[model samples]
Target: MRQHSTSTHLAQKSSWTHPIYTKKQILDVQTAHRKASSWQDRVALSTVKVLRWGMDFVTGYGTYSPISISVPKTRTMTEQKWLTRFIFLESVAGVPGMVAGMLRHLKSIRMMRRDHGWIETLLEEAYNERMHLLTFLKLAEPTWTMRCMVLGAQWVFFSGFSLAYLISPQICHRFVGYLEEEAVITYSKAIKDFDDGHLPLWEKLEAPEMAIKYWQMPENNRCMRSLLLYVRADEANHRDVNHTLGNLNQTDPNPFAAKPKIEIGLPQLQQNGRVKD
Candidate 1:
């Protein structure tokens, strides 16, 4: 029999803890995030996406911030509920600045900018990747509260990272864009490994801590994971905007290191030893 690393705690978590959830449960989360029967929910979700995009771009760096910053994270039951519920925000945020791209793309779709067609598709692709984080967190964190911390830490990281861009758009944005692209790839592959049922203890730590945990973990694969892919894809969309602006960074002279390969629907754990939603 295969030596299941989680065998010891798996039953423990399954009994009182929520089942790790199969793909279906994960998909339910995706559906909750994407679809809204009520216009209010739809409007709220869209508003949240757009607003966070603006705030993150204006401040967040699309990278992990240090723990020293004031990010408003707290420890409480309500906080825990919010942690699990709001985790979707962080997952969607893997591709920092993506919602802005979509909004921008939509704004210019009629203008017929030179890169309009590909650029819009770029943002849409990135948006899809941003949504993958909901499932990847299972591998990254054991509890919902930790998930919020992970999400908040990314915000803090991006807060600092964006400062570089704010200070010097020409040089800093260029370098930062490249860094975000790398983050995209790195985080995407992270989704894959985490989802594959590796490293539970490490994941239980908060996002701020996971930043280091990710660094400590041995390389299980070359990719950043599906979650990160969404991140990079979004950055790619953001970069596409640079070419259109009358700015120094029209495009990376070096171009992408490797063509982005995005895949959806990775295998997930079965619930109750049977694959049923």
Candidate 2:
């Protein structure tokens, strides 16, 4: 039975290797987005202020300003906006995982104990975010100045998050939860813009090869909107996981649990040649 299930899963995954969507189908996705509410509509943007105040509150306004100094004032999803955002955010996103995983691993070895299996999840989170960075670089193709910015941002964030995790794991996990909440909002806005015909850089562009493989995108759902959908789902999953971890005590059993899966769907086209989604 296990073998049969495994084989079925592999077949389902392999079905995405070939393109199954038409240009009309991809355009249908964008058309449907025009009627949807965007990420900016969230009250969290005004209250949490992920791009500015949320981060400031996390680090104590002046304590770590370099992280935000290089960013621009615009909040939309232009090519430049997403490029810089992902480059910096992905760099920092991987930090908490590494720090938490290493700390747990060391603690287990030292106490001659086990971690209740939390270390693997943390490490996988770090690896997945790192891949997100690499995937974006193929699109952004950063200049020297942007590369420098990435270098500086990674160094500061690594140090800051490491220190925070070391001092208080609960607070560190909470900060990550907040960060991912911001990430979900950011990607939603990007998806709205891209699907609403605002981003020329992504106009009629196919999903990145890496994104296609990582998300195991279905033949009909292999477009930019779908890509963003998968990425946002990942952030949402991370948000829940970190929030759970933040509330857990070391004595708690099974702090690590499986994340919920996001459903994959595509915009459908009607026989009359109109989008139905």
TM-scores, in order shown? 0.30, 0.66
Local accuracy of candidate 2 as per-residue lDDT tens digits, 1-277: 0011111122234311323434444333321111113342233224334445644332222211224433233433456666566666776787779888898899899999877667877887887777678667656666776677667767877787677666777666666766777777667667766665666766656666666666667777766567666666667767767765665655343334333211111111122222221
User: Which segments of model 1 are wrong by more than 4 Å?
Assistant: 1-93, 109-115, 138-144, 150-177, 180-277
The lDDT, on a scale of 0 to 1, for candidate 2 is 0.59
| Clash count list over all predictions | 26, 0
lDDT, each prediction: 0.35, 0.59
User: Which residue ranges in model 2 land beyond 4 Å of their true spot?
Assistant: 1-76, 258-277
lDDT of 1 by residue, 105-126 (tens): 5545666554323344434434
Error of 2 at 27 (Å): 17
List of clashing residue pairs for candidate 2: none
In model 1, which range of ten residues has the least summed lDDT? Answer: 261-270
Candidate 2 lDDT score at position 193 = 62
